[model samples]
Target: MSETPLDPRLDEDPYALQKHLGFRLTHWDVDYARLELPIEHFLMNRAGIPHGGIYATLLDTVMGYAGCYTGDPGHKKLALTLSLTTNFLSRPIGHVLIAEGRRVGGGASTFFAESTVSDETGEIIARGSGAFKYRKTRL
Candidate 1:
């Protein structure tokens, strides 16, 4: 499969958890983020389906990133999730899973975001929403 061109910032320094999950940051922009993951055996459960925790992790990560876009790479933005909710809609059927997130609304210090996980067929398998607090950055 041809690899998707990802945002360069993703390679700068990813957290260990992100690397371990093996999801790629395919896109990022103002109030938006998109990630993709190839289904792997290790990510499946005993029932041979992707684990629920994996879905939650992807949802949280994407949503948080949706609100973290800073036009300037040097000025990084971070957010701490205050609350997160994931709703599994259906089981996915495909070799790859795609997650997309969008920032909804909030003030400067806090924000809200929503996300969905979809299969290669474009069927949404999971949905999520979250509230986050912007972290203070050192001047």
Candidate 2:
């Protein structure tokens, strides 16, 4: 048996922030996407919990990917966020954080998506929704 190969684009993601944060694209579909991150002590805040910025990033990235997926997972689409709203619920202390995104609605040029972040133990850390516009050309 062999593991499925990773999307080469992931190695050179246009979003430098994702590469800097070591985000892994675990799954993706036409209207859905999931990203994962292993807990790192350095990501914690003064309260010893994951920073809100981290939560916000998970939400934004996941929801953006949900909008980006065009049918063929191999063809990566670029979606720019027009607006994003996040609601932080709890703090994550688990070894991993999982973010799942689902496309809600929109038309040809734009899209809407919602996403949730949870810990390995199934604790929801945050939820978010966003509006995104597809780029006219590929990056």
Candidate 3:
């Protein structure tokens, strides 16, 4: 049997197109993916706090990527966030932020994931849970 080569998209920085959006894919396998994002001025709301949408986006991206890890070879899957609930636990005041996500349940076609956004000091600023559906594409 031959080994499948790594997907090139995985090497492309997800945040390269978004200004001030920095993300690092720390770990990923067939069933999981973990990423981190930094909190910058562009990600803040009017109150000088990290915007809720930013948290939502980060959660969605990380969780979606996790699902993609379980998809078939050469078949890319795009995940759509069907529902998401976020709880703001604390204010993140720092130069950097960290976001981690993991698949909690479900399968390759659909799944639920949990994510947390924290400051550099490891204080959680927001927690999120979301349901996503995966669509297989023939790209």
Candidate 4:
């Protein structure tokens, strides 16, 4: 039988809350991570596309998680976003969005990662790259 993943909702950090509300980390490895978010009224902007901020948040979360996956399994690496640059490529019109993140460089203390958000049909909606500082979580 497949094992169920632990709930990230129990996390007390605000950043964790934001991530849980948008997308749950579904896949992870040493080099890649995947996440997904549902598109609802709350996620929309006045222009009717998914808000740019939502895309930014999703990208940041995925990239950070990707970095964490590269760390030792028992040591949880929490990442703080240092800088993020996003390029919105297309307007997304879907009920769900997917994000895939991959590590670009660096190691345990600092890292660079990039993520791309796309709609169900595989249209790229946004792409982002960011620098993050990784630290061990306090016991």
Candidate 5:
């Protein structure tokens, strides 16, 4: 469950990559974010399972958002990822993937976040941590 509903502004001007990948922002708060993706055929690898890159993408997006939340809908904080590391924990099972991220620690200019991707059954598919630098301007 999420602490807050996703802001409509997110879908109103979605990121190109997020829109193309078909993941939707599900929740956001001061130091947290969540995203969900319905598994699609195009997202699978030749072996028929969801691709590793898909997991990585979800982890990256969620972790970045965890540190960039701003309460105001008219203004947005941005972060440039400095580094990201993902660990594949287990194969996901089910039709949907859920990713949740939390900001762990940081200063004004840089921050750290950790995230997890889980299947519909709540099995963790991957875990990730990242470092990001806040952008100077708001979006």
Candidate 6:
């Protein structure tokens, strides 16, 4: 994970909700983007673990970033998700969640991406994939 970031804004993520939830970009490259979501008490359920919705959100955000990147900060690719699927693997316990996403395949207008989310201990808690259309727009 990188300490200092080039930009916190992800082209695929233009919503204010992500920042409000304490999501931060930890790593980014030509192939992938990694994000970290804080595991605050409010994010937990009665079971004392973060809710599945939180994991799903992180996965989707990272995966969307993966497919929409053009390797240039000034020029960005925007993608709208067409389909998304997530699998909850286990219950995770930690102060934060680490998510990494990569582009799997696609073409000029559409793309596929896969994302994995893990706890602070590096235990995978969820996985997801998404198909998106690269909307010809820049943010």
Best by TM-score: 5
Worst 10 residues of 2 by lDDT: 1-10
Candidates' C-alpha lDDT: 0.88, 0.82, 0.71, 0.77, 0.90, 0.81
- True-vs-predicted CA distance for residue 137, candidate 3, Å: 1.6
Deviation (Å) of 78 in candidate 6: 1.1
**Candidate closer to the true structure by TM-score (higher is better), 1 or 5:** 5
- Of 2 and 5, which scores higher on lDDT? 5
Clashing residue pairs, backbone N/CA/C < 3 A, model 3: none
**Which regions of candidate 4 fall more than 4 Å away from where they truly are?**
1-16, 70-74, 136-139
Q: TM per model?
A: 0.91, 0.86, 0.77, 0.80, 0.93, 0.86
Candidate 5, residues 30-120, lDDT tens digits: the string is: 8899999999999999999899999999999999888988878778789999999999998877889999999999999999999999988
Ranked by TM-score from best down, the candidates are: 5, 1, 6, 2, 4, 3
lDDT tens digits, residue span 1-139, model 3: 1234435555544555443577666665565666666666777799988788887777777777766673454555677888888888888767677677778888757899888878778788888888988776534
Best by lDDT: 5
Total backbone collisions for each predicted model? 0, 0, 0, 0, 0, 0
Model 2 over residues 38-139: C-alpha lDDT tens digits?
Answer: 888878899888889898899998888878865553665898999999999988767899998999999999999999999889899999999999998874
61-92: candidate 4 lDDT, tens digit per residue? 88988787634444566788999999999977
Off by over 4 Å in 5: 1-3, 9-12
lDDT of 6 by residue, 64-107 (tens): 88776666677877788898899999877667799999998988
Candidate 1 backbone overlaps, count: 0
lDDT of 6 at 13: 53
| Model 3 alpha-carbon miss at residue 12, Å | 2.5
